[model samples]
Target chain A: MAGYAVELRAVWKRFLGPAGETVAAVKELSLQIADGEFFALLGPSGCGKTTTLRMVAGFELPSDGEVLIQGKPMGKTPPYQRPVNTVFQNYALFPHMTIGENVAFGLQMQKVGRQEVQRRVGDALEMVRLSGLERRRPKQLSGGQQQRVALARALVNRPQVLLLDEPLGALDLKLRKEMQLELKKLQREVGITFVFVTHDQEEALTMSDRIAVMDAGVALQVGSATQIYEQPNCRFVADFIGETNFLEGSVQQLQGGQALVELPGGLSVWASMAQPVAVGNPVTVAVRPEKLTLRPLEAPLANQLQGQVVDQVYIGTDTYYSVRLASGQTIRVREQNNLAALRQGAQPGDTVCVQFVAETASVLTG
Target chain B: MSQPRQSPWLAALSGLVYFFLYAPIVVLIVFSFNVSRTNVVFEGVVNQGPCGPFYWYCELLQNRSVADAARNTLIIAVTSTAVSTLIGTLAALALQRYEFFGKKSAETALYFPMVTPEIVMGIGILVLFSALFGWVNSMLPPGLRLTLGLGTVIVSHIAFSIPFVTLVVRARLHGFDSRLEEAAMDLGAPPLTTFLRITLPLIAPGVLAGAMLAFTLSLDDFIITFFTTGPGATTLPIYVYGLLRRVVTPEVNALSTLWILVVLTVVGLSQWFQQRE
Candidate 1:
């Protein structure tokens, strides 16, 4: 690897609140995006994901700290001076100009030659699968087509890094899914680093090679999708990424990197320590619904517990069971609706043994 | 698509209101063709005059003072519209985009001219100009002394027209998506280039509407023009007012008809341009 395509060194962005107090939108967050990597800043609203994206785009400067693009320290460089492009959420296509002009805008702004602009604009449009609609204005295009035009407009510049601020937020669910795959494919084809900000966890998981999950102006965790979902470092990251069953427990013993935690009702389960924990300290064991197997064991087993199925929902591919443990803690289990599983499907009031994929389950301290 | 059902009485009332508004102007236009110099009675179209059916229009063209007034009106209207539109658009942009000291006060003050009586503002401008001229004239030589003329009238017209232009342009700027500007900047256009390539084109309709409004106001202004105008700087309105003091001739009617036709054509052209965009 040559260097990071983009880096934020302890960036902080503070804004004046409506009541005249300083509000830190982004608080001392640092990240390094790899070259040609598809990275996502995933968070709920008010979590400073958009602010971080804007800071990278140079539209909003950091109140403190540094943003480096391609190993160059960009200290107070205006957005125009930055070698980056942005795809705004609304697509922000120029309504007054034709699609040809909109796509050619960045090239013309850089004072590219007339013939070069025309050829590159045509190529960029074709790259986004919008070759024949150059003469049409923005209003004349459909929503998905406008989104493609927006992509072409940015991709035409061929910047080192492309910043997208919730680019697919406005699309319908079906279109969003299609565009998500198309964008990933296009990013791979172009081989430019992408740093996209979004609130949708599935979109991040489905597209990004690495994801930084943020909450309340702080990046809680940053890792790959499997690492983030299978091994969350914190309770917030675990809950934010996907539905996780948390059982309150105290550490009984530590072995290798795993922990033996004793739950209420004298039940014990073995869980992986994503973050180190002290023996006799209270922690929460997080296990995903799909990771838990609901089967009746011969007797009792390590990483196994007893529960009665209080609710079961058949959702075509999988059956979701809400099982209540003897300690009265509710845990949801998702099992595939195979023929054998369906034949022995447990309904409400049926006692079943819930097995944990202990190697993948996380014990979070906070 | 289903439209709301219209009431016949409401339609009749609206028609009556339109007639009430346009009847006098229509009468003024029709009377312009009268052959009689006294426009009190509707004389038949002049088939015997040198210009055939356009007798009064010919007379209106022959009036040298009226020609001077028309020329002065055009100069003042065109100059003030151009300058006011430029300055007012900048003012609107600053108000909409930037935050500075006294911004709240400035926002409130922008609508003062729109709300204040034109006659009151005219007198205030007249007094202010007189005071300024009085101060400067005392220091300058008599041969090169400044006086109230087209300059003062244009200045006053620009002052009053700014609030209107700013209001219209500011309203347009409110709907503008600032992300377009950022997108341009990210594409390597500096702030100025982004404004020129993106911001200006989008808000152009609002700027044109404001300019048109300023132009019409300058063309038809009487009170403000009256207070600031001097000898040889009389506008068409002032000239028409002067003529009404002694005689009510068909020349005035012909001038009014021509003015109405030009304003209509300009408005129609602007509407067409907006639709074309």
Candidate 2:
């Protein structure tokens, strides 16, 4: 816990194609993670998340920078010399060996004493809840079971860093969710630095302590889940993280730190921050569907607009309404269902007023 | 639409094709016991001119020279097949695993010997050994002649069998998952240990199949061995050729039947092992 578990400094990797053409897989990326932290690289496909993980695992070497483990630079260090292990996407379990043998493979390679290897392998399997499956080959297990065996194999080595490259991508939804919690528990018990890579936003949000969301080989933001969801820095993260309602308008007037936005047809709305926009600068206002509150047509409130409900959908625990404003812009509003109280329902042609607080919305520049 | 009754035309055509392939072997086996020496005859049923217990067959078996030749042939076939499979499988793994310059050229070179004419290869080897060492006849025993002996025959069989083994092993390697080896390496195993413990076991069935093929090919080989063997190193095929020319004896037919039996046994075992995997 005293030293950084892993450090990657200005790493750049380029792959040469068959015809002498170079394709940059990763640009200069520098990052550090303390001991026992669960850091995740979240991004879409071809965004260099997997490439970055491979470089740390020593499967691929960076063309321009140095990688370090425990305060020592890794120059041409083979995978066996590095104190790190990787769980590949497809599990990569040895089909010819039994589960116990696969787990003991690393210990046997180090020529550890026989009894010690067996005890550690058993403990690793038990941690993953795969006890008593020692003699079964990988082909006999289900996809999820195979993935657990792979995890056990990598963990048996007691490496300083565990690199997971989309380990749960091959599993179905239910199994993936179950393993997500299991992995979190295992990480806590082992207390090692875990660097995981995935393209699923929800998965990252649920398990990671810190996330680095990347796009096209560049990391756009790194923060806690709440920060990433509530205050995305750009249009990509805002659209990728969750659902948002966007309103295009220009800043009609700015005072102090707040600005009044004028929508088309002279409808004015107050925005909380004018840091990203000046007077007469165009911007898009983003508000969550749950943030907008609906009321009767006669209610009077600041930032109030009258609109007709065009459609309504009743989910199990909530009701959603599509409201059309006077200028023909449709806005979505969600209301929680209260089973104990009875109220009048909004119809397709009913006029309604919707209001959003000034602090509940933010403006997007691009 | 209702399916038509079994097509008589299709059945007849396929039956004719089967007959076209097997008719010669059937004719040869049937005439092996013929009594008349006119080289062709229908002996019909019993009392066929006092057949004398097919004495030509017993005489052939009693000859010590024939027994020695059969022993030599079996030794060469088994040994060469084993060695060639080892080399071929290693070559196949190298070709399939790594990316390097001249890979395509290396693959083509491995297959080149398989397609070359046997006579040309035999003559080339004979010339090279004689010109390089000058020991073809001047310094060798009679049984160790370059054109006829156990050593030359084994060498020739191994040369031709390697390409077939490589081709079969390469096909199996194509479907293999190399990540299994990577996993082993990550687990702290060295490169060679990973290959032996994980990769080889997964592809053992393919190696067995390739060895069977090499054995069968070596057992039946004639042209190459005829050019490279010594007098004492003559194999079953060369011996049968001599009998077929000198006397046109029924003993040759009996020998041919034995060869067919050995070939079929190897083929059956190969198929069984392949299906088991």
Candidate 3:
């Protein structure tokens, strides 16, 4: 069996800018995708996710390192020789060819027999649910159908690995949501290793088996969706993935996988530790908005702080409360709309308790 | 055209412009049917001459020099258009697709033939060919010496026509998306296969337009041909210039009418190609 479907070892890409300035587009990135795994490279624009995908597809050569497919290093291999295919962001289908011919292009390039190519193209179109569109050109299809044609065009090759660069980015919101689930099901049915690139965090969370979150040409963390969201390794990953409140403090003591921190407001709190921490070292406690609970200030609560509701917004499914602590820091709290008036009708200028346990918060030192 | 905002004044102005522009050609075509030989004025048409309704056309077919001149014009136009279109398309592809040293300079240099005055170009080519022939004759014996001929005129036509062809092709390329080539490569087509199956077919209309432009340019060229042509290589335009100095006949009107017809058909075909695209 082929080992990993795709691998990158210490890859780096440096581009010379218009003014002769060198900028590192991707830096020291090494990753491995298991066979049949749906791996995603997620980041903001200019974060090098697209560049990494291009390097894997052989559109751009790494300035320093190797890319491997099926456990074999591909050195100086042209894109047409590699055992992989790419679905470009623009869906670059040939305008001169019909949908059937577009899907059959790869097979024809490989010199497959005529009968086999015809049968395989018909089956591939059927797999994408575009059975009767064999005679229609790309311009005649709708945006969503054209997207399916791009998918079928790449999947017809049955390459060892498939690379997708924001394949659904051009669609409207409703169509993009539908395509997200369709792509996941399609990947499983084909059982091909899919390496997707996207900037949408929710898409990566919904579709990827594992994700590498990148920023500024470097991958800050790589993990499952739950691990990245609940136990991020750094503040950037925590803030980038979701809304998190940072409470600055210094470590007073270290317990079993937990740190006791003293806040600037003279409050001592406990937060889960994911990395090494020394006593008296400065650290930031990151807690998601939904993780923190808000209650009336006079309630009998342990480990709670007095805060005033600064603002309140009801967004149909949930209500967001902006609360300001006595120590001059504002934090957001989210509560489900199950409650009648959102946190029991907590309005601006009302006093409340911002309460959280150690398990809901993580300590970040760097 | 869909806006429906036409004003009669603007329409009348354009109509007047068209009348002025086409009146001379219309007069020429009408005179080709005139039976009078001198063609100073329209005497009559149809059943007046023994040669039939197309009297001047029959005279033109019988004239030997007209046939030779027509043949020479076709040979020069076809050969020069094919060569210029090929080389110019290659130059356009190279300029548009690659990053190289002096690329800016090369792109700017293609406009030299386009912006330079055609009369200046004609004189320069004459002096250059004369110098070249002088050097070749000085080295060789008298029987084998090179001189200006059909080959020299053809070379000059190709030189002037390339810039127009390249500019036309380059304008078409400005709107092309390069990612299609990458997608072809990703689909396992090699570079040559991708170019043959994808690039050439997509850019075909632009190449045809450039070829038509080159052909029309080569057909009517007179100044360059006048200086560079040798014995027995006179094209229709140069031959007509010689006839102008000697006599003004209705056959010249017939030739001009035929010239206008060929240009109109070529232009019609080019428009058809663009609309099909």
Candidate 4:
């Protein structure tokens, strides 16, 4: 990665209320994005991600600390002087201007030569695959088209960092998926750092090289997608990133990286690691559904736990089973639709045994 | 398709309202060419009496005082509209897009001029300028009496029109997204340039609509203009008022007809502009 394109050091922002009360929107946020890196601020709404982005954009000023762009302190430097462009969630295209005019707006402001402005505008539009839509007003375009126009307008200036605040949020499900791929490709082609903000976990995982999962103005974890998904640092990150079946228990045994946990009904299970917990300390064991294996009622397997099949669902690619374990706890297991149509005729009352490797699940200490 | 039809009483009530509103306008247009000066009775002969339609219409057009009044009215309307629209549009943009102390109170203050009675506003402005400034008697030439003539009338019109302009433009600005300005700014346009190149063009239609409304308000204004205006600044409405009390003439009907036509033209143009949005 190149030198940091944008950097924030312990930035804080406070909003004053009508009654002179102060509310901190962004609390001591410190982050850095290298050149050409796509970083995502992933969080639920009002988690200070947008505030952080706004602070970087100079739409807001930090109450404390510093914002740096290309190694310069950007204190009170207006957005126009900042070497960054923002793709707003609503795709805020100039309603009065045509697509071409909107793209040429920045160039015109800098007093760029008219010929150069037109040429650059054409090139930018072509980059976004909107070459022929020059004369169309923003309202005349579809939502996706307007988004592209917005992208082209920002990208025309070739900003060092592109800040996108849920740019694909206004799109429908299928369109959002398509735009995600398009954005990734655009980011690569442009080779500029992208600071994207989103509440959607899947979007962050799909698009970001590094994800900062935030909650309540605090960043819980910042890591690669695999690190975030497989080895979440906290309970919030574990629950937020993906679905995890949590089994609360005290650590019965802790040897090296593996641990055995005793269940409530005299059952014991082995897990990969007991997240730095001492023996008899409370912990929640998290396991992915696909990690477990299901066998016939009497089939022998390592770490056997007997259960009855409460529900079976065929999802074309995989068949899912909701098994009621011996301890009255229900756990889900997904099986790939292999050659054998296993458990097709298994009724809700039929008994089954669930098995999985010790390393497939991890024990999260609380 | 399954809903019951509207009652006849409701339809009759609506028709009565339509008649009540337009019947006077119809009477004015018809009596503009009334053979007799008094519209209550029409002589059998048309254009044969001393109060002929052609003669009165000619008199109304040829009268220098009426012409001067029309010119003054147009001048005041256009000037005040221009001034107020500029100020009001900027105010709207500032109040809508920024966060500052007492913004809510500032907005309320903008609308305060609109709520205050025109007579009250006029009298208050006059008293403030004359008493507070003291330049009223000491600075100005004789016979001025601190009355600003055309200037005072335009200023009063602008004062009344500003609130309306701010109101209309503010409504448009409220629905406007601030992200566009951010986008422009992000792309390297300075704040003022962004406002000029992006914000102003987008909000221009609203400003225009408000200005047109202001012009109409200024043109039809009588009480405030009458209170503020000196002898030389007799606008059309004041002239019409004077004619109503002074003498019987068909020229008022001609002048009234012209005024209605101009109003209709402005209203139609404004509607056309508003619909483009």
Query: lDDT tens digits, residues B1-277, model 1?
Result: 8999999999999999999999999899888887777878887876656787788888889999999999999999999999999999999999999989999999889888888998999899989999999999999999989899999999999998998899888878888999888888888888889899899989999899889888988999999999999999999999999999998888889899999988887777656644544
Clashing pairs in 3: none
Better of 1 and 2 by TM-score: 1
Q: Report the candidate with higher lDDT, 2 versus 3.
A: 3
Give the Cα RMSD of candidate 3.
2.2
Please list the residue runs of candidate 3 whose C-alpha ends up more than 4 Å from where it truly belongs after superposition.
Answer: A298-303, A339-343, B1-15, B46-51
Give the chain B TM-score achieved by candidate 4. 0.90
Query: In candidate 4, how many Å is residue B211 off?
Result: 1.5
Local distance difference test, per candidate?
0.91, 0.82, 0.91, 0.84
- Tell me which of candidates 3 and 4 scores higher on TM-score: 3
Clashing pairs in 2: B147-B228, B147-B229, B148-B228, B148-B229, B148-B230, B149-B230
Q: Highest DockQ among the candidates is held by which one? A: 3
Minimal lDDT window, size 10, model 2 chain A: A336-345
lDDT, residue A254, candidate 4 = 80
Q: How high is the TM-score of chain A in each model?
A: 0.98, 0.89, 0.96, 0.92
lDDT of model 2 at residue A127?
86
Q: How accurate is candidate 2 locally (lDDT)?
A: 0.82
TM-score against truth, every candidate: 0.96, 0.86, 0.96, 0.90
lDDT of 4 by residue, A144-179 (tens): 999898899888888888899999999999989999
lDDT by residue for model 2 (B146-239), tens = 4437887898889899999888888888889877777777777777888789888988888888899899999999988887787688899888
lDDT of 3 at A104: 96
Question: What fraction of the native alpha-carbon contacts across the interface, defined at 8 angstroms, is recovered by model 1?
Answer: 0.97
